[model samples]
Target: MMMVGKPVYGIAKSRSAFAQAMKSQAPQQTLDDLFAAVARQVPEFGGMFLGDNEETLQVYLSVVSPTKVVAVQKAIVAVFGTSVIPKGGVKALQGQYGFLQLKDWYDRMTGPILRVSGVTFTDIAEGRNHLAIGIGKPEVESRVIEQLQKLAIPRESVVIEVSGPIETLTHTVRMPNSMSPWPYLRAGGYILTRLLCNQTGVGISQATLGFNIIGPSLGAGFVTASHATAAWWKLDTIAGFPPADFYQASGYYPPHLVGRETVDPHGFTGGACPTGLICRYSDSAFVRYNSNVKFGVGHIARTTGITTSVTSPILTIDHGGSPSGEFLIVAAPSVPYLTGLTLNKVGHYTGWTQGKIQMTNANFSQIPSAYIQVGCPGGLADPTMPPAGATLLSQYVVGDPTNDVVHSGDSGSPVFRSLKGLALRRAELYGIVWARFAGTYKQFIFSPIGGVPFQPTGVKTDLPPFRYCDASASPPC
Candidate 1:
């Protein structure tokens, strides 16, 4: 079944019922309106998520009063009707702080908390209705708690756990079969850029193409990880490497031109990024295709016989398979909360893999020395290093306990959810994969597609508008 909306609770009896519930609006829009209504009715709305059984919507509030509980119940019934509500109705729980307040604390404390040695990531756990911090060293937990206490942040409002360092997912291998020879470009296809690696000693760097995007006035282009271009900064000392050129198969002699690097903001000094931190809304970059190049709008490549080993030399990409093998991108939703939603991605190295979202609105940072050691070149005193801090904001953390959900060379891979019940091989585009945590193959991170910075504010997926038609509608409808 295809579950839609944030905290998508309960199950639809049929496809038509689901469509009617959503009406003409996208699932996300409908849910957003409902949540907004609840927030308006209840001033102390903390957050919401699905119950453990996935049957009831669990709403949390700073103060769980009878009047507020009734308001939340009314909001749910008004938006989704009584049938959608569970037998127990909408359950309200008492929380230590409101969601907005926690978010404010999250934003204010991310830099300071990350500055603590061994801290790996920080996020707001909506289900728990509090802030969650992950540290690489268990011994550092007390120090982190002390920092929070110094800020007057309630000890009961936060949870700390031991974790591993998060690292970029750029692969360096000599896989001749990873290249795409097809005339039309598609998402998940292999893309290589040798400009940055020539001096770093990391040979033949490769990444997966995300998806096709177009601006009303900017024509067409494709998106990938900005780091994949190896041009993170404007002052690249490497001669003839200012703007990295991307190739379809290989950058060797008779290179197949895919596109030219266009929009990639190195780092912003202030705003959502904090003054001293090298921060980016998304770890993505735009690549404008050549004039004569042809591309698929929302098509994503499918492969079979994927290798299980993370260090494997090659992935068995099946390009000549039937149309059923391809996944059609039907919709793009800004998933607000992703605690337990199942999502999947296809990459050049890992092929097709699926995992559940563990956290959202998460922040992760890498020290300048660690980043530089892994192919990037910027010393602590260099312009690339942020004097204050370096962190990524609003990232999705996904994991699969038993397997490696993502690997090197998987950066820029399209992350999406399967909507097979609605239409065969149909899916919704969610975000793009960028990095994974070290010492564990179980987790990786992605940035939402809507976060990609493009000019004119009209840039979006090239796919046609998605709509649901009645059974009696006209053939074209």
Candidate 2:
């Protein structure tokens, strides 16, 4: 890599004012300008982030081989201009099609059985590059290694660590509802009452709205865990009635449409076990916002208690000085897991809970094939097990065993990371609560947005546009 000594730009008067003015621009906008310019210069960009100082921007360039680093670096400098490319800022990492090679390899080796839980790359004292993997169990790990060997992955090229148990986290919907009392506040993560069940009882369960989605079909609506809305997927009329004066997180009850039930054209049954790793092929559904009803963004609410073992405090969304434009939380792509990153979630049952990401790109075998249901009658394609080595599986696994951070109505609650600290910070959407380990109290599972299938039927909504933060923050943050 060629080192470009720091090139100084002409200093302007009132430096603080200039910096403040720049900060006033939406963070997303700043990211766009930098990345767009960088892409025009070097097309093979993978990802970028704020370095330790939160000012030095590190731009990742995916290279086919180590020898191409200099050429790519030159191209970047030629396009970005000398001063724009921070001194010693460009990282020319070798990977496939602009992604880390091991990242691609982990996706391939795990097949559909294991979601690639987490990935990390580092060079230690000996100066040898080490790739760490958060794999599941020995049974699954052995199978993954066999696949790696077929790809010629020498044992030395990687290190594997057991993540959470290899077994699938229990799907919350598949279990019995706790029938917890509904809260007064309506928000993204809460229990929506009176789902008519085919069984002998009215379905009383919990769910969360992952985010608001807008497309051509209707001006706006929200998406939630597919299984949470599974009962309504194939039917139009809700057989049971909700409590009078009842409203949902969206501030409206189910519409009276005769034949319109929640649909999941991409439910678990679709094929090869559609789960959260890929949103398009996920266990999620969309509920069109009923224009006739009034709604408000009440903000996600939860209890401040750590778990049932401790006393709880009522918790609600903490508004901060930062003005979160348009969306409070935006989608993030799946990547290797970082051990100690703190994650926050607000749900109808748990209220407010903070935990660490135990695994990423995790896989679960417990998806009962019977639960699969595509949106259309005949279904998109005959459901089948996805072939091994398919490149599209990524999701999250909350490995903590004691917190019970989520519960019955928690499915679909937004999973996010606060920008600064937990008190009051802008959050980057990571995934949505989907499942958990049956007997475990704290373990939770989520679907990563990056793996969400792109381009579904119905009026199309463009992938949320990328906005730049002044600090070089990018999407999939």
Candidate 3:
């Protein structure tokens, strides 16, 4: 990691001024400059990771407050037991570069904005090294812009940032990913798919197969959400699991690392792990089979060379979508659980995906209750594509009306890509889910996503206009 500091040059100065002025005044800041700057600063974004040149890592960030970053850090600590990412901005870092190195900040989720640049600087409390103010160069702006265009996230959803520059900054105003002060979901934790389920008797056969995701825990011993309390893997490795959890709730839940359990304490079985340790969620429930023993952690099955969770991602089923309704279970792909074939849930956001919906002639199920129809945000991937008549709702799935896909109790579950490979955030949503469908599908679903608990902007356009309290009363707080 090299740190270079110099006076801003002519081209750099001009680009910096233009970017700064635009960022300062413009409601939506473009990141073309920030990404390019990082690339010019480091080669990781420039395909250096791929043995390619001139390609700087193209990093795009959706605006987040320092405070929220800290809260998410806490959630990461509380939910996902693993230091999965470095101490500072691991998720953010992954978005910037193609991959992240975990060994550096194993206990925390923090790091520099860009790593490929090999530019390192220690924090200075009173004296220096805190270049949080601005980018010091302009030549880097082009690379940032180029990468931004290449990464292709929504312009309205990004706030461009670059390192090594003082004024080479861009602010891209975006729809808030989290609405509430608390984060919705914490990175990789055991996810649950919470739907109508009668887990007791004859109902188990008629149970509605909900969606979900689950992560391994180091304390919970085995898994939850399964028919049994312990969610032990049926087969080793992710090749068997589906997603993260068996029960999927929508709210904020982090990942947990299960302790390794080596079989023979007296060298009876063989190999290294004789008895594995135990992993648990913040709830203090033991999760996986072995805790201390690290598996053959390898890069995800993408060409990106990113590592993946060696254990199977779990899924949860929502009997009612609550701590009571939720149960954690392993989604071993090879084990076989889901009844229907997973469809391609397409959307524009890299961390966002949608489910293939078949419009029915029955009635607008969501309408007057949970209606997601035409005119929704990111409505259609291809309005002119094959599925012309069917409409894509604003939300990826039907969630609680006040909040959607899920609400207060519905945090921490994976908005899964059961069929897709575990690469690229696996093209999944990585935040809190706080809304549900309030209308019927026969009509259309309109989504109004806010920071965390954002409500529908105008769902009652059909009903009489009425003025009411916008938020829950906090006892006249």
Supply the global lDDT for candidate 1.
0.59
Backbone clashes, candidate 3:
188
Q: What are the per-residue Cα lDDT tens digits for candidate 1 across 382-471?
A: 113323465766677777667677787788888877765733466666778888877776677887553444111232321212221212
Which residue pairs clash in candidate 1?
A: 171-409
**TM-score of model 2 (CA atoms):** 0.51
Task: State every prediction's TM-score relative to the real structure.
Answer: 0.74, 0.51, 0.18
Query: Model 2: how far is 279 from its true place, Å?
Result: 8.4
Predicted candidate 2 versus true structure: per-residue lDDT over 1-477, tens digit per residue: 001000001111233322232222211111223333445555565434323322343445554455555555565455334433444465544432342443344344444333432221111100112233434344556755665577675666556655443222112111122334332322355444323332223333335555544444434455566555423222122323221122352222333211122334432222333333322323455565556533223233333333442235233333333332112442232211223245666555565666665543334432332333333232321122222322222345554445556655567666666555434544555556766544354656666443322333342221322221222233222
Q: Which structure is stronger by lDDT: 1 or 2?
A: 1
- The stretch of ten residues in a row with the least summed lDDT in candidate 3 is 166-175
Q: Residue 100, candidate 2: how far off, in angstroms?
A: 4.9
Ranking by lDDT: 1, 2, 3
Misplaced by over 4 Å in model 3 are 1-403, 420-477
